[model samples]
Target: MHRPAPTHAKHCCSLPSPCKECFLVSFARGGSWRPPPCPLAMGNTKWADAGQASAIAGRRRERLIPRSGPPVRSECLDGKRGETGSPHQLEGKTMKAVMYTNRRADRILQFTSDFPDVDWAVVWSPEEFENGVADADLVVLSNRICTPELGAALARGRTDRLRWVHFSSAGIERGVNMGLPRDIPVTTSARAKAPVCAEHAMMLLLASSRRIWEIRENQQRHYWARNELNFTMRSIEGQTLVLVGLGGIGAEVARKAKSFDMRVVAVTRGAAPTPDVDDTVPRRRMCEAFADADAVIVATASDPSSFRLIGSDAFAAMKETAYFINIARGEIVGESALISALRAGQIAGAALDVAEDEPLDPKSPLWDMENVIITPHVSAAGSTNDYFRLRALFAENLNRFRAGRPLDNLYHFDDGRALPATN
Candidate 1:
């Protein structure tokens, strides 16, 4: 059954100029009001009851009108509303959005209920997604449930109704590789995840610099080796740190690194000086900058051109005592080259939060290396704070989408990267 229109005056017409005859206004003005005749009343002019009239009225209001003008008198289901030629507005019809998520269904429903005009469907599995996406006007995708096959299906199965695709995570390289429809606008939650991921990178850098694994080994043996480790222990203070790809994550890392008195040099396409970076070098001269760094971090996006961007030559360019850390996608660094660099002691040590292939081959030599620290890609794992940030970002974007405004963190299909945040 259709839901009833709101009875309160404030909940009546949201348009700029509401019709004077709208019954909701009469209710507020303490004037006598009667149910209007609905076309759906069994082909009769009169409704069966007040409840039936309300249901019909609610359905009519669900058909969204243009934002700029007064409400127009038009048929609800006949598609005869005023045309604004705006991609954002869905004239004369309600929008249906299908979201694939692992979040609790009740929570999603409660949040979506605020917008009665939108029909929201939340699915938990790939099978449900295949069935639910058929008539959807918008799709909210979770990274955990996304795959190349599903991406291809989405691209192929897209209808004229499909307008936008949103990712709940920072990384969209995998989504880009999924062959999503290029014409539809795509966005991500990268801005929300940057600070947490940067903190994780700093943790890895500090642990690697102090040789935490060796300290743990001594503790396990019940031995005191303070003097033995002291000579080798290093501080990040006054060391030069180089960052590749100064996007959201990179910028955050640079800002935090400066707090430790580290000199930050960033390699980016832009020539403008960044806030936290002490020096900026073009991508072509990144190797020259690497030669002077005491540590290097990979925080760039992964694309075809950037695949294996830090290979043997790049590693060989770093100082022998310099540490290497990869908090970004593993494919951005050649795994074999990194392994070789570690084995030959070309660099002091390395830390990895992501791998080229996750669940990283149990037999891989990196597992046994004394100098290497490997985490199972849990850098952005603060559930409590992350949930709120992701929700706020999506909600803001949804509002912008309805208002015909440009979205934040828009993913570029041509480059397989998000538009860098202007602020």
Candidate 2:
């Protein structure tokens, strides 16, 4: 018998749980933390040993921060189809869905090879969409859909066939502003992001320890004059690490950060304990956490409350030698403030993979700084499979939707521009 749908307020996911599922949410939360509105905690993991994790200096730990926001509405199995018009209220302009547009070359290759059966368009410009987007079956918008015109195109395609979109990256900052169609299911590239980001965070931490970048500069200037070492090089074996944002990518960064024997502390919405996270703290106390950290890695997803989460004040509070690494969104930190922190030597340095204005201009002053290392939003992505993998995950979710099975990565009901569920 079909059990009466439980009230949305009592549980997370705002619905009954799915069984025999490959995509799962697993964690301990005293039974109050249900899976909905995205995760507040990841699976709990034990701290790593400094003795076994060779050549590492810091201890490993993790934590969480309670986040507050309006509780999103939930729906039943077959809610009414969303209205066919621009979701203009969310963006204050029209939003439109577009086609495949991942930046990574490998993901492009793998996605095409895997989805040979699905007929999809790979349009590069809006001008090429002459027939108008409403007629298209599906628009596989990659990460590049952060523009106002693309928003208009998305606004134009407010009908059937615009059911799903596989975002190119895991950050979801672009998605928060996309005004996703209410009925369409938007999924993230989170699964594909974890490992690559973990590796990058670890690399920055290790590089800082070995003095690789500064050593290179001395060599380039041919300054071979002998002198006593001025600064002490630290080890990862017994120091502390505080990771901001404990989602898929953040968790992976934590696991690897632990492998280096560093303590892992994390901040997330709704105070709850999860595997690998130590001490649950509030966002206000983040600077205090940083003051004691040897390395700080931020891998948070972009949400309404997260814009400009870090600024110069936080940097000023950090130890002068501490290294700050951001593999998350760029706007999360103030660029002007970052420059001030680095130039005044308030903090040792920063290793950034993303910037406020991405593909940072060649004329930007960040290029001239000796203490900062900037990569063109390349650290968190590693393979072409992130796209193919996301597409396949979406395909599986599509199958579930068709079978009247529960959906995975269901965009929490908020303001979105979606089509009727496409099974």
Candidate 3:
């Protein structure tokens, strides 16, 4: 039986399934909090102590301002193929898709409605997928569950029937870290959720720029620190924001940066010049852009080539007053280098949404730094519309796959990253 959509009201009290899932939503009401925002309200005030169970900063966390656009219509699954020209047509064959996820009820129901023709298997445990992969034609994986055993199973040809793998999130660094085979064509929901993550990047930038972390720390001690914050606070309007990638998330960040009257410089992998960027540079020349930037935002994808790209040399290139922001994978940065830079005042401050080692070890210096703002990988949260958009993309891609068309957001195995959609 299909669960009906929640009431289409301006404010919804309905919570998303998998409540503990990171990148979740939190809505606000007049003054009084509806439900407690994140689990951070518990005794653990330090982000590092919260470990893998960390949520976006509690009630005080900024909400994602809704995007101005028409709502996307959900595609009905009725054996009517998509009109998009596909390169790989399924002909009359039906594909078998196995999803290994903890989001059982809502996700399973949505997948069923979207791909009614395909054989569906929802494996909630690693054991289930280990036993079931041999017959699966497609597998949808999330970063959290891409364990070593699963990777070995997929790599060892346990699933000759598996033609493709789809990752739910933008970062496949975890899959790469798990030693998953790079041969299978993979796709990610990277493009679908760019706006949400970009908005988060801006949030961290603004919060760090305005010294929100210090204000909160002072608030806890009942100390009036206005004079101190005034010295630290800065405006974004005249600043230069250098984005590390010019992909969907970087493009959105550029667009929003323009609205604030900030100049946006981008470093991309030879992607065409995007509209909002003031200038573009190849990744090799990113250090030049960093030298002049007021804030260096890491929005690049993590891959074999990009691991530890922002080491001591990258930090040494930045202006002493400039802030460092990472909305991308933490491995893209050298944790020790960032800490050393922060301690030595090589950079004014740093804001990080992702950490090199998540749950970030309790002894990490970042947790104790007054100039740093640490969030537990929740930058992609609060996009209520993402579920609809993600499902729509998958359905459209499923149609394309059946038609042998190039899938959208196709992960390039050779490049070890998601390629820009061709369809």
Best by TM-score: 3
How does candidate 2 fare on TM-score? 0.68
The true-structure Cα RMSD of candidate 1 reads: 13.8
Q: Provide the TM-score for each candidate, comma-separated.
A: 0.75, 0.68, 0.76
lDDT of each: 0.70, 0.56, 0.69
Candidate 1 vs. true structure, TM-score: 0.75
Q: Where does the lowest 10-residue lDDT sum fall in candidate 3?
A: 24-33
Please name the candidate that would achieve the greatest lDDT relative to the true structure: 1
Cα deviation in Å at residue 211, candidate 1?
A: 0.9
- Scanning candidate 2 in windows of ten residues, the lowest lDDT window is 65-74
Which stretches of candidate 3 lie above 4 Å from their native place? 1-93, 103-109, 156-159, 179-183, 221-227
Consecutive 10-residue window with the lowest summed lDDT within model 1: 68-77
lDDT of 3 by residue, 397-416 (tens): 66556656677677775666
**How many pairs of residues collide in each model?**
0, 54, 10
lDDT of 2 by residue, 1-423 (tens): 112322334423433431101112221111122432322211221222223221111332221211111111122224322111112221232333345453454344344433333444565655544234665544555555566566656676545655555565555556556555656656654555566677887887777765667678778988763452245456788777888776667777777776776677886654245566666566788888888877788877666566788897789888988888888888888888988888888887788888889789889888987767777877755653244235434544434433445555444544221112232
- Greater lDDT among 1 and 3 belongs to 1
Higher-ranked by TM-score: 1 or 2 = 1
